[model samples]
Target: MRQTWRWFGPADLASIDDVVQAGAEGIVTALHHIPNGTVWSPKEIAKRQQLVRVRKDGSPSGIEWDVIESLPVSEDIKKQKGAWRELIANYKESLRNVAAAGLEMVCYNFMPVLDWTRTDLRWGLPNGGSCMRFDINDFAAFEIHILKRPGALEAFTPAVVEEAARRFAALDDAGQKQLARNVTMGLPGSTESMTLEDVRAHLAEYGNISADRLRQHFIDFLSEIVPVAEEVGVRLGCHPDDPPFPLLGLPRIMSTASDYQAILDAVDSPANGMTLCSGSLGARPDNDLPAMMRQFGPKVHFLHLRNVKRDSDAISGSFFEAEHLGGDTDMVALIAAILTEEARRKREGRADWEIPMRPDHGQDILDDLTRRAQPGYPTIGRLKGLAELRGIMTALGHREFGLQ
Candidate 1:
């Protein structure tokens, strides 16, 4: 596996120098400054390439941009409404531009409204580190009280609804505001500045859109673009729905193995692959991470190797990011599964045998807390995770030589 890092461009707290020092061999970033539904000009792409290849002192950084973390699937494209056709054209052009610049493995998601949601950004741990968390009761409270979306109560179970009501009743205005801020923070990465009204409006639009309808829109998107991906020699990987569940009564189409199966069946091309995110998929107890890897390994073009500890056995419950090997998912088994896939690809003479992986979100520890880093991305924490994963891969690689 090729270890990589996700950098949010120049404004990111984690600098390009940090990536090099952390031992990441590649950069996973995008033209975040570029607005959605616009073509990425080759000039802009080249500028980013140059920035990634050199340090501020003009010395080599020993890494270049490898994968585009995303190329933003616009809301227009997701709903197949408004100027969707124009946006899709822009996307195709962007695809061509990136491929022409010698980059492959583009990642995107089809989640409507919010690409991801979390109720708490700085949940305290017993170890004194802070990590992001999604408590089900708090989330339900947001739906029933903060955003106050129509029909929000019916979306959750009766027990959850009751718990949400109790939780909402306990909060004063200040707590309520903080809860709202945490949920809406997902807007930044989704690239939309939506107020509560804007969120209401977006939810209303999807109110009439069913799960099947949203899924067809996703498939409709791939049918048009996957051919272009194949022609451009780039693999387009759709990231799974974060948390892997429905939120705000919005339809979630990419939450399970079956969802991915349908997607692969619809497009049925090597270019149409999965960005296997273990954290998101592992949030659900039903999703066997290693099994899914073995099943979809051939079509998985990207990897987000992180772990989470769910509070309950239920699919839609609270969970938090855990240490790389300390979560519900078995890190050893998962890495071994990933190696099996690489071995198979090597035997088949596939050029993309070594998959690109990045240590996903990490807890805030030591200087990480004072660094004011991106919510889920912290320097020391993620480096710790990468080190652990690297250790596992190394041991697994040398197992035949008695290293195991």
Candidate 2:
């Protein structure tokens, strides 16, 4: 795998120098300032390409843009509502522009409303470093009391609902407001943000959209864009749902391996692929990360190599981001699968044999506590993750576990 880093443009707390200092070979970013549904013109794309490849002193950064973390898909496109046609047109044009700029690996998600939900952005760890967490009771509290979505309490189990009520009761106004912000405030790198009212309205619109309906919509979306991607040599990878389960009463279409397989089969094009996000899918213990990697490695266009510690062995439960190797997903086994796949591709002389992987997220430690870097993406934390992952790759590379 080619080591890469995710960099939010200009406004990111971490600078290009930070990425270079961390020893990333490539960059994963997007034209975030451009609004969703608008075509990313060639000029705009060129500007970003220049930004990634150049430094303030006009010297080479030695890292070029390797992947587009996301090209935001609009809600209209997801629901196939008014102006969706124009939105798809814009998307196809954007895809063409990106490919024209020599960026072939692109990642996006079909998750509705929120990009990725978490009840706590900075939950403290025993080591004093903080990481993001998805606490089930706190989320249920948000749904039942904060957003007050209709039929929201019915979604959780009885025990969860009771605990959620207790949790909600304990909150003062400030606590309640903070929870609301954590859950609904647009996360970093997300396409859109929402107010409680905005969320309620969006949920109402999706009230009738079932999982099957949403799945079909996603297929419909890929049906339209996949061909354009194929034509432009762009490989589109759909990111799986974070936490890998339903939330806010919204249907989750891409949470499991079967879910991904169905979408891949429906689209049936090499351009149609997945962003294998270990942390997101690992939140559900049943995901079987290594097995899934072996099964879908050929179609994985990009990689987000992070891990999570699920609270239970059940299918859907609370989980917190874990250290890259310390998490439940068996990092060694997963990366071995990736290397085996890469070796196979290399033997076949495939162009895209090596996947671009970034240390997706990390715990806030050391100076990270004071830097207050972007939530989940701190300089030192990610550098630590990258170093750990590199060590794994190097050790595995030196040993023989059936690599050609």
Error of 2 at 70 (Å): 0.9
> Any residue pairs clashing in model 1, and if so which?
none
lDDT against the true structure, per candidate, is: 0.89, 0.89
Q: What is the lDDT of residue 363 in candidate 2?
A: 96
Alpha-carbon deviation at 307 in model 2, angstroms: 0.8
Which residue runs of candidate 1 sit more than 4 Å off their true CA positions? Answer: 187-191, 399-404
lDDT of 1 at 316: 83
What does candidate 1 score on TM?
0.97
The residue-by-residue lDDT of candidate 1 on 1-404, one tens digit each, is: 99999988888888888899999999998888888888999999999999899887889998989999788898878888789999999999999999999999898889898877889999999999999999999999998888888788888889999999999999999999899888877533334555788788777666678899999999999999999999999998889998899888877899899999999999899999999999999999999999999999999999999999999999888999899899999988898999989988988999999999999989999999899788888989999999999999998989683322
In order of appearance, the predictions have TM-scores of 0.97, 0.98
Tens digits of per-residue lDDT for model 2 on 1-404?
Answer: 99999999878888787788888999999888888889999999998888888777788898899999788889888888889999999999999998998999999888899888899999999999999999999999999988888898789999989999999999999999999888875646654678898988877777768899999999999999999999999999999998789888788999998999999999999899989999999998778999999999889989999999988886758889999999899999899999999999998898999988999899999999999877899888999999999988988887564653
